[model samples]
Target: MIRLQSLTYAYRKGAPVIDGLTVDLPSDRRLAILGAQQSGKTTLVQLLAGLITPSSGSIERLARLSFPAGYQRGFRMASTLGQNITFAAKIYGADADEVIGFVADVTGLGAMVDRPLRDLSVQDRMNTSFALTYALPFDTYLFDNTFTVGEPDFRAKCLAMFEARSRTSGMIVATKFARTASQFCDCALVLIKGQATYYDNVAQGVAAYEQSLPVAQPKPAAEAPTGA
Candidate 1:
């Protein structure tokens, strides 16, 4: 379970990104966070994932949470895919051999796993990283709009992997696409003006989000150039 109490955050010299938000996130469920670009969806997820601390309030986390599984920033650019996986397993207290076997089978990288990260193609690198994430033990996973990233076959495998993980772990996925959110989430939270609107029905949440889009006001007529 994860609990937030009066969570608030703001950037320096900027309005609050998340304001006085409070919520309890229980385990073993998928939540979709909906927002347009720069709506603080990423910021909220980072707070939930323990990547960043809130400016005010506190978070009580009881689950072993995985970082954004779709992220590749943590990889060692100079090391082999296999070496990276081994290092991750060691850090997470997982068996290196088990992680290697899982990554090999899932990514089908074969001998390429032993090659340097710099040597692999983009697709191979992404697939390997995704596989490596599952090699550790985590009760919850964080994702930031990473549901799509590769070839059709690879994507199909990723869908299957997510489905399998859904059976046992919790997930918090942030996405701008309402349809995708409805497809994978049991509940949704729409972020607007640094506040969250909760909806049990994913479709309703999407609808609410659609309704909240800012209507562009017409620009005022350009002032005639004043004579100097």
Candidate 2:
């Protein structure tokens, strides 16, 4: 279980992106965080991952958490996909060969596993990244719109991977896609204007979100001004 009390953080003084946010995350469940851009979703994840300390709150966790972001093949674009996965496994102190084989099977990278990251498609890159993270034995996983970076079929597989992980561990995913949240998450947290509201069900959260959108004004039918 993870507990937060009076969590507040900001890049600058007197202005907090996450303002006094306090909530509890149940063990072994999937939670979807819904928010517009710049709504502190990533910041919240960072805090949870211990990458950043909250300015004025307490966070207590009973398990290890892992976050997979900032993953890409740039300068070392020549490294094979399998090599990248193996590197991550080694960092986590797992058996490299077993990890590679397991992730390759789970991600369906198969033959492409030995290919360089630069040679892989966008979908393949995402698969490799997820497989690398999932192969580690982290108690909690935080994903920030990472699963949506691939093709539909591959994205489905990524979602399945997350579901499998949630069976034994906790997961908190931040995404703008309501459909993704509705399909995968058991609970939802809607963040609006720096405030976080928890929902017991995803459907209710989605409905509330849809209702909060500004109604589109109907275009007036084109008409000649009456003889004015």
Candidate 3:
């Protein structure tokens, strides 16, 4: 459980991305954050994961929440793949060997784990980033549109792993896609213009988000013969 009180964030004194948000994030089930672009979905997820400090207000986390899966901010480009995994495992209190084994197996890196992260191919980097996601365990896992990683086959593997883990771990997914939310989440949190509204029903939350979209202006009925 995470309690947020008057949470707010702004970019360089610009309008707040997240404004005065105060609510308890559910950890017993999956909660999908539904919002259009620039609606603070990612910002809220970051705050929950403690990746970024809020400009104002406070966040209190009661459960151990993992960083957003596929987040590469922790990667050390200069370090070897094995060394990076070892460092991350130590930081997250996971087993380095286990993490290393998982990544190497999935990426076919084997002994190549000794290679620097910068030397790895794009596919290798993608595989390792996701492989490391499940290498550690947390009370709650956070995701911000990180479902697909690496090649299609590797993505399938990641999905399989996530499905197994979902049975026990809490999940919070931030996405603008309705299909993603309906497929994986039970409840939804809708964000609009920096404000948040929680919905017990995912469909209802999606409806609210869609309703907030700017409606296209209908073409003025071809001004039929105005003042002749």
Q: Give lDDT tens digits, candidate 1, residues 111-134.
A: 877788889888788888777776
- Model 3 Cα lDDT, one tens digit per residue, 4-111: 899999989599999999988888678899988878888888989888899999999888898888888889899999999999999999889988998888777887
Comparing 2 with 3 on TM-score, the higher-scoring candidate is 3
lDDT of each: 0.84, 0.76, 0.86
lDDT of 3 at 225: 75
lDDT of 3: 0.86
Worst 10 residues of 1 by lDDT: 141-150
Candidate 2 residues 146-221, lDDT tens each?
Answer: 5544667756766677768788888888877788788878888887777788887889988776676669999998
Error of 1 at 195 (Å): 0.5
- Distance (Å) between predicted and true CA of 207, model 2? 3.9
Query: What lDDT would candidate 1 get against the real structure?
Result: 0.84
Which should have the higher lDDT, number 2 or number 3?
3
Q: What is the full ranking by TM-score, best candidate first?
A: 3, 1, 2
Q: Tell me each candidate's RMSD, in Å, in order.
A: 4.8, 3.5, 3.5
